[model samples]
Target: MGIHDLPHALAVHLFFTLSSVVIGLVLGVTLGILLSRKPKLSNVVLPILSVFNTVPGIVFIGLLLLIWGMEAITVLVALGIYATFPILKNTYAGLISVNPQYIEAAKGCGMSQTQQLFRVELPLALPTIIGGLRMSTVYTVSWAVLASMIGQGGLGEFIYAGISANDNGLILLGAIPAAVLAFVLGSLVDLLQTYTVPKGLRKRGSTK
Candidate 1:
């Protein structure tokens, strides 16, 4: 492929990465909140999800393809699930890690459970939760390339086509952009942490 084709491929790559990350983030954060509220659920749910995480990306995609067929939904769902684990773990940890003192303080202020969660807990958890998002985004960028294996077409098209043709330039063209894209997206997430995290916790880490 030439420079002209790169734009279309990049769009496809972004679609695969962004769509998956968005779904994963929402689901993960919601699940995390539930797990924190009912810690016992983690004992049952986490291990099962962990098993899914351990599965190789390609194998997972292939399995999903059997059910969803060689369709875009298959790739989106596979990549989204792949992206969910870290965020879910971090969100739960961040929420539960809040100090008892803080919880008591909020309660003393007459803040209800939901009020405490939104105004105090989630704000404090921002740093760690943002870190999870960064991880998920970077990983999905690499994984999204797998979209091409099933004909969805992303940078993987170049990578795989280059491999078959033994063309180093084509391989580098694909690999470099993907690596750069991952780094750029990760950096953006870093910038986001400053704005997302509570100002109080910016310097002093959140306590347990």
Candidate 2:
């Protein structure tokens, strides 16, 4: 791959990473909320998720490829599911970890279950939730490279090509950008937490 191929590859990589992470965030957080409300269900469900989470990304993608026949949806579904585990686990943890007193206070103030969750629980959980999002984003970037294996296109084209030719330049072309992409995306999540997390919670999270 030439330098000219870099932009398109980067764009494709970003597309896979961002799109999958967004899908995972929505699915994870939604399931997490439901699971938090049902602790017994969470106990059963979370362990199952953990088992799936241990599957290697390449193996997962390859399994998906067999079922879907190298479609972009295969890549998206694989990466998206891989991205979901951390977010789902953390969201459940964060929500359950919210102070019981706050729940009582919200109840005393006439907040409904939904109101208490949106107004208090989610806000308090923002820091932990964001932490999971950061992990998902960074991880998905690396996993997105597998797209090239299926010919869906990403920086992985450069990486795999480099490996075939033993060309370090080509490998660096992909590796550097991927590393930078992960760092940049991870930092954006941190910045998001700074603004979205409550000040007191941010301080407390920082201390921990």
Candidate 1 differs from the real structure by a C-alpha RMSD in angstroms, to one decimal, of: 1.1
**lDDT by residue for model 2 (1-208), tens:** 6999999999999999999999999999999999999999989989988998998999999898889998999999999998888899889999998888888999999999999999998988878889999999999999999999999999999999999999999999999999999999999998998898877876678312
Q: Estimate each model's TM-score.
A: 0.96, 0.97
TM-score of 1: 0.96
Using lDDT as the measure, which candidate wins?
2
Worst 10 residues of 1 by lDDT: 199-208
In angstroms, the error of model 1 at 194 is 1.3
Task: Give candidate 1 regions above 4 Å deviation.
Answer: 205-208
lDDT of all predictions: 0.91, 0.92
Number of backbone collisions per candidate? 0, 0
Q: Can you tell me which runs of candidate 2 are displaced by over 4 Å?
A: 206-208
Error of 1 at 138 (Å): 0.4
Clashing pairs in 1: none
In candidate 1, position 12 carries an lDDT of: 96
